[model samples]
Target: MPVFRRRKGNLPRLVPELDDATLGQVRRRLETSWSRGSLDTSVIALVARAIEDAGQDWDRKAHRLEVLAGAAGRAVPDMWRRNSPNDQGAVLLHAWSDLLQAQRGAEVDLAATRDACHLAADLLPADPIPWTLALATLRLERRPHREMSAVWREIKARDLWNREAHLQALAYLSPDECGSTALMLDLLDGIRSVMPPDAPTAGLEIITLVRNYHRAFGADGRAGIGAGEHWRRPDIARALDQAVQDWLRPGFLTHATAVADLNVLAYALVKAARADEALEVLRATNGVATPWPWNTEGDPLERFSHWYGRVGSA
Candidate 1:
């Protein structure tokens, strides 16, 4: 019952982000707003409703806010903040959208964005979303390590299993980002020692392995060389084994972004030449798909469905 379905109408719908019936409704509203060139008041009301729907569930609130921010038209957040400066949702969305834009090579006012984040954290001290966004912003800016660590501490202090917070950390410490390979590996190792198999971070290790694999071969020869066999290497194969054995356990990954994490795992399993394992994971998605690894191929849903078709009867 996802908002988006595949062509030929077979498998469950595959949205680019984590979604449910409630979020589906919010997405529809946002879609309409976009079609009509929505102004701040209209979009803000819709986004505010979504935030209220999230209640006190930090994970759900974080996911909803991030999704809505990404889905909003580029000017939406700026106007929202400008018009509704006192609303925490607008403040956070403004910062979050700026972070997204900055990641895509756009110029953003980091200082003002940082101020917005601090103001948001002050407005809702219990919520980790602001700090999480701040962590990402700090990462993108390649600010001092102590600054990154400080923001990270605030996020973890609020939501210990914050998936986005951990993701930002991984990206920040990545070789392509501010940190080195050894630092990234150390971060992964630290997480494995303490994090449970089913926490929101269950997909972190697999993501690291997959991204590192791609970083090595890259876009040039990944498709040209012995890609299939590359995944069967001892390290990657072992990581896949761990993910398959642990992540697929029912009710294990219960966080808000669980579906998105499953998509990552399913994509990794597919690339690892483990179609059988991938099938089970894909079915668990119930048609929810992320625009990640699959997007690396083409249209996310199309690529995902192609793989699903290849292994359907398994």
Candidate 2:
């Protein structure tokens, strides 16, 4: 893992940490390419090498693609596709990056993206990434549930426990995206009882409940509170309790995305006014924090830092 940090004596300063050191190296290399205004064979080779090395490891592949898609300039994938017109990596990267832009309110050629996903599927038929990104696309488009389900079936056939696959399904069923609260709760019912405690989605129920907790309060994550606390609700409390009890146990959460679930646990604990309980989970993260759950409240780093102090001083 490549460390990016700006630590103070007691403040929480965290950055993204990739389980693959090479991926972190790849990101730094991409940054250098972008800085030098050079997009060359090295660019294509490095990106493809990372993807190829990820091979059929669906979870790591998704994480690598996400890091690339997020770290890359839109032009990188476009140039790769233009030069290596039949490269499967280029097709997957282009479509995935474009879909991410679309989610952030950017306008894109959705039809072309769909075609690229189809191309990626045919090029690497056993891989689940193309279909997973397609699931993300369908979610952004607010496409009908039936259509999303069809895409999901495609992903499940390739990799049933794919973290991003189930996450997309969770988001698609979430009220924040397309589904109703009742619908999101139904999805939770399907997940909570069965998802393995150490799976990529270890803290999934906490995620759903936390999002629903925010929905009650408004988009800014601090709007409504008329006497009762959502965190104190019977079922929500139990879910948090389960996460704290199991997630911190040694040997659990061996997935590539374990840090992400740990972040969810820390965030939920703090949000539920159990900041002290989050200390162990936060330590397990080892200074890698994600922007979700915290982002909905305010600057993610600031919020996490505040809790770091709150939990520490206590």
- Stretches of candidate 2 exceeding 4 Å from the true structure: 1-11, 17-20, 219-228, 310-314
- Checking candidate 2 for backbone clashes, the offending pairs are none
Best by lDDT: 1
lDDT, candidate 1, residue 142? 83
- lDDT of candidate 1 over 1-314, digit per residue (tens): 33223433446556544655677677777888788865547656777888777876887888887777778857778777888898898898888888878878898888888899899999999989888888887887789899998888888789887788888899999989899999999988998889877887888888887788678776333664567667878977888898888878887777788888788889888777688899878877776767777777678888887766654444
For model 2, the local distance difference test gives: 0.78
Each candidate structure's TM-score, on Cα atoms with residue i matched to residue i, is 0.88, 0.88
State the number of backbone clashes in model 1: 0
